[model samples]
Target chain A: MAGARRERDIHAATLELLTEVGYDGLTIEGVAARSGVNKTTIYRWWPSKDALLGSAMVEADVLAIRLPDTGSLRGDLESLLRQIAALLTGPDTSPVVTALLGAATHRPELGEVVRRFFADRLGRELPMFERAVRRGELRDGVDPATVMDLLAGAVWVRALLRGQPPRPAYVRETVDLVLRGCTS
Target chain B: MAGARRERDIHAATLELLTEVGYDGLTIEGVAARSGVNKTTIYRWWPSKDALLGSAMVEADVLAIRLPDTGSLRGDLESLLRQIAALLTGPDTSPVVTALLGAATHRPELGEVVRRFFADRLGRELPMFERAVRRGELRDGVDPATVMDLLAGAVWVRALLRGQPPRPAYVRETVDLVLRGCTS
Candidate 1:
């Protein structure tokens, strides 16, 4: 039980270091220092610094937050985007995501983690769109997968490149644009 | 004259290495070795590897290709998308963009370079949409910037994450989705 507690302690410290120093600047020594644990303890649990961060990142609140079903695609999407906005603007998580993506250059597992997160989120939200299709709210032959990509990609572009925080209105607009097919 | 010539040779060699080694694996030592230029010269010109690649990326055909004016928004967009497709599918430029974006996680200049590239491209393309608006083809309050981000972001999401290459038809669908607003 103590060992398990210690391992959790190391993961928490790793996430702290990831947000502070970023992926490139994060070192095993730094994690050990921050966590008040021995470097050997960190190494004992994870193969490398990447593995530790990757494992800890999986436990981040960003992944744990469940998507709400607001009974309308528009409502659910707005809520989803608002949640993402909160995550992006919230303390440390933005930089954590940036660091994760940045570190993924060398560590392919990081990319896989990011990919899995997106896929999982998509998986949760996609059924809503599919329900819309079944109800004929969407056009025939509309690929829910493509729509998912577009919707998620829009927010990602703003976050990753524009460095602009997500706006609830922007998410609302995106949901409107995709669902109704953007009528003037 | 010789100094300028040498710089061009070095930049050219950097592109070659960019294609061969990608942005992640590209090192100053590798650039110097491959280009046959001294490492001192590279360090003298560029402060770091990201800086060297940032400049080389700007110099590459990535932004050098011109967007065509087909006298219609649809035609012009198709032309632009084709150019983007060419750039993405062309020799090493897309991967270079990805690599540079990968580096952007750690390096500020690289991120700026990417942002500037998007801004420039978006700046040029926004007017085309505006022209459509003037012709009453689009809504009066449509946000061209948002629209641009959506289209470009979709393409980028594919490039950066999905391991799926951008196709000309994907561009067409993107244009179609956005144009749906304009047409009504």
Candidate 2:
């Protein structure tokens, strides 16, 4: 329990540092000082700033996404999109994602972290369609990626490309219009 | 005609250098050497590297997106997606766009360039729905951003998040399903 708690603190501290300083300004020393974990202990598990940031991203409870089996496609999608918007556009994590993406564009290792982060998050979100399938709400053979492309794509473009904070009206309208048919 | 040709050549060279060496590697001197444009003249027109890059992006022939009024909603969308995937994922301009985005994340000045680039490009693309709206093929008052969001989001996410090159089948299937009805 103590080890688990300490790791969470370390991850939290890393994200906090990332948010405050951007990617280039982040240092393992800064993470150590912020987390109160000794530098030697931090280095034992992670050898580089990239390694530490990757671990923090992959292992963070900051991504507390709860996938609800809302028994219908619409409800599940709304839950999923709202959660994603909150996570990606929220003040705390938005800059962290942006900084990581900037750093990841240049570094393959950090790129893997970005890939894994999306894979994990989108993977968890994909199962929301299962209940819809079971209830005949969605077409049986619908490609999950298609649905993801529309929902996640809309969310990302709205946030990143347009630079708009997530709006409830936009989210609701998108859910209604974007998911009219998960059938292809 | 010679002056216009010279400017076009400069923008082309800037994109080539950007794709080859990336953002940090891109330099005004390199653009000058590549384009055969004098550094003093380049400096006279654009004060800094960011200015050069921004001008090159905004004023380039690289984004030759022709919004054809194919006389139907589906036809227009398919054309739009196909062209975007080709331009953004094509061998020449993809890395240039990627490098610019990474650099723009931190620098607010460069950030304005990115915003303008998209606003200009997307602004042009937005009128694709005009034919649909006029033809009564799409719902009246349909938000053009929604349509752009679904289409562009899929394209960008495939390239950026999933690391998959755009597929023709994807472009077609997404047009079929993603744009089923723009009315919300």
Candidate 3:
């Protein structure tokens, strides 16, 4: 129980540092100072700064998302997208996401984790689209899985690349564009 | 003449390091060692690592793209997507892009440069879609620019996250989905 408490404390300290300093600027020394854990103990649990930061990032709010079921593809997608947009804009998740994305470029291991995190989330939410496909509401040969990637990629590009917030209307239109096709 | 030659050599060395070390592991010291330039000289041209990296990256192949003047929206877009996809997957540009994207996550200054890069690219390309809109090729209320975002974002997501090369077929389907609508 004492060990668990210490671990939680250290993780919390790391998260605090992440928000303050970002991934690139974060240091194990800072984590040690902030958490009151000896640097050796941190090194014992995590091999490198990247590992420690990655572990700390896992403690952030990214994985808590629950899929919504609104009984239709559009409604369900809209809800999921709204939640994602909200998360991207949310204070707790934004910096962590930004940091993780930064880390993933050079660190393929972290990149895999980020990819898996997205895949896992998409796994839960994609059934909504699958349902629509099964009901003949979508076009033939349209990949349900790829749709989520496109949706997410679009929103993330807007958020990360363009510095734009994922507007609710933008989410809706993106969903509509994917499901119904963008044609007249 | 000596100073100009030295500056060019430094930038070239930095570009090489950009590929070898990537954005995260890249350092001024490393650049100096690689370029045979003193650290102060590297810092003299660029104030920080991000700025130096941004300068190096801007000199990479990304600037070579020209918005095609092919007649018709589909033709122009297909050409653009193909060229963009080639640039994205192209060896010289890929590592530079990956590094720039990672840097943008943490460095606001670099982020602005990256944003301007995309805006310039997308800004030029979007008018092609607008011409389509005027020609009634797309539906009412659909912002040609937004559709352009979806298209570009979709391709970028696949490349960035999935590590999958953008297929010509995927580009075809994406263009079709955006322009034709997907509903049966």
Count of clashes, each model: 0, 0, 6
Give lDDT tens digits, candidate 1, residues B1-184.
Answer: 1277677777777777765676667788998887788998789889787677767655554446575767777777667766765665555566555565667776666677667666666777777776777666666556776766666667766655654677877778777766662111
Clashing pairs in 3: A180-B182, A181-B181, A181-B182, A182-B181, A183-B180, A183-B181
The TM-score each candidate achieves on chain A is 0.73, 0.85, 0.72
Calculate model 2's interface RMSD in Å.
Answer: 4.3
Q: After TM-score superposition, what is the CA distance of residue B68 in candidate 1 from its true location, in Å?
A: 3.3
Query: How well does each candidate reproduce the native contacts, as fnat?
Result: 0.34, 0.35, 0.66
The top-ranked prediction according to DockQ is 3
Give the least accurate 10-residue stretch of model 2 chain A, judged by summed lDDT. A175-184
| DockQ of every candidate | 0.31, 0.38, 0.49
Candidate 3 CAPRI level: medium
lDDT for each residue of candidate 1 in A96-154, tens digit (9 for 90 to 100): 66766666655566667566556656677777776665555666555555665566678
Of candidates 2 and 1, the better by TM-score: 2
Error of 3 at A155 (Å): 1.4
Which ranges of candidate 3 are over 4 A from the true structure?
A: A1-61, B1-61, B69-72
Tell me the deviation in Å of residue A104 in model 2.
Answer: 1.1
Write down the TM-score of every candidate. 0.72, 0.85, 0.74
lDDT of 3 at A72: 76
